[model samples]
Target: MTGGPSRGARGGRAWREGHAAEWIAALWLMLKGYRILGFRLKSRAGEIDILARRGRVLAVVEVKRRKTMQAALAALTPHQTARLVAAAQQVVRGRKALQALEIRLDLVALAPGRFPRHRRGVGA
Candidate 1:
């Protein structure tokens, strides 16, 4: 078999972690009755891992895969936070249905084999 970690192991690890975060977030959103509009939403600044809606509220979510809350908190640098906010604003502007919707930012932080912790209304 040609199975090995040498085929870009770092990339593989990142990809797997990303997929895990998405799945975890998606399941959580579904359980909460939020309709997921998109995942990995990108713009000139950065990516919003998940964009969802519940009632009249629009949620822009950023996903972080880390070993702890401290690590996840550190992962969101100021520059990264600015970029995420910019991208999310762009997303809001681009959707007519979201034009007048209440916007909120969310962070879904996860450690491998652990449940995700959600932080809502994160601001720039």
Candidate 2:
């Protein structure tokens, strides 16, 4: 009789929602003509939600879900941004296919009842 909900309960809900948002973002990118190279790619730097490519550009996408577009866009901080960039570098280093592509950090912000807003070359 101390806390609101157990850690597992809260974490499970968040994990499920994050996964759903990432899938939605991936589909949206596909429709826009990008090929998804990976999802939930993890490196020692951090976790990249999605890795997509179009022509010579490789997009390292970070998905955010919030009540509003503004909130979602504001969710990532400078430190987090740095980590994302570092993660993207790590991802490219590990994938020979990504070697020749131009890597960019992108943001895909999703809110309820709204299409995902994509911001390319963010934190670059």
Candidate 3:
């Protein structure tokens, strides 16, 4: 008997899609002059979707994908924001290169066929 895609397969597809959004977001940031420092940075605190730098500013970016930009912008919960902030701290501590830069929380919302909306200093 042929079976349909398993739960894990569906989850894996979602994961790949998420990562693809992140890659697109990263490119978008680069086009805006921010140097991509890291992607999917994980620590005991949490995971940071993207980390970038421009001059003395260190941006901790969260990438979200949804059917609409509004939904993507609303995706980050307060608890998750706290976790991202904490994780950014850990990320900076480990990387001496990021030590001197001023840290800021940023958001990148992605939807199909639209430019990524980058909001800086979001929930910082």
Candidate 4:
């Protein structure tokens, strides 16, 4: 067998990387004045990586970490995007206070040795 980590080990490392990426994204959002409302929230639609709010903007954030920024950005597929939006809507539906806020699908793309790139209003 060639020299490489086992499948389980690779999977575990990916999970750890994802978890750390989420934390980094959260901190980046908080520093930008967004209040984190939820982290890894599991709703009827899907699992939302992060839910944040700043003024009237409610951001449904998806955190992605890969070797490159392009890879990170490409990680969020259309189906996943729809799920994220649905999850955000569910959160809004459950809270009357969030009814008036604008729901924005945001992306926090992370790569090694680089600052997180937070893109807002990515629904379109």
Q: Against the correct fold, how does model 2 do in TM-score?
A: 0.93
Ten-residue region with minimum lDDT total, candidate 4:
115-124
C-alpha-based local distance difference test score of model 4? 0.92
Candidate 3 regions with alpha-carbon error over 4 angstroms: 1-4
The TM-scores, one per candidate, come to: 0.85, 0.93, 0.93, 0.92
- Residues 1-124 of candidate 4: C-alpha lDDT, one tens digit per residue: 8689999999999899889999999999999999999899988999889999999999999999999998998888899889889998898899999999999999999999999999987776
lDDT of each: 0.81, 0.93, 0.92, 0.92
What is the full ranking by TM-score, best candidate first? 2, 3, 4, 1
> Model 2, 1-124: lDDT tens per residue?
7669888899999999999999999999999999999998899999999999999999999999999999998888899899999998998898897899999889999999999999998886
Per-residue lDDT of candidate 1, residues 1-124 (tens digit) = 6676676887988898788788788788878888999988888778888998899888888888887766875576667778877898887888787898888878878776677777788663
Candidate 2: regions farther than 4 A off: 2-5
Provide the global lDDT of candidate 3 against the true structure: 0.92
What's the TM for model 3? Answer: 0.93
lDDT of 1 at 108: 76
Q: How many pairs of residues in model 2 come into backbone collision?
A: 0
For candidate 4, give the lDDT of residue 8.
Answer: 92
Residue-level lDDT of model 3, residues 19-87, one tens digit each, is 999999999999999999888989999989888999999999999999998999999889988998899
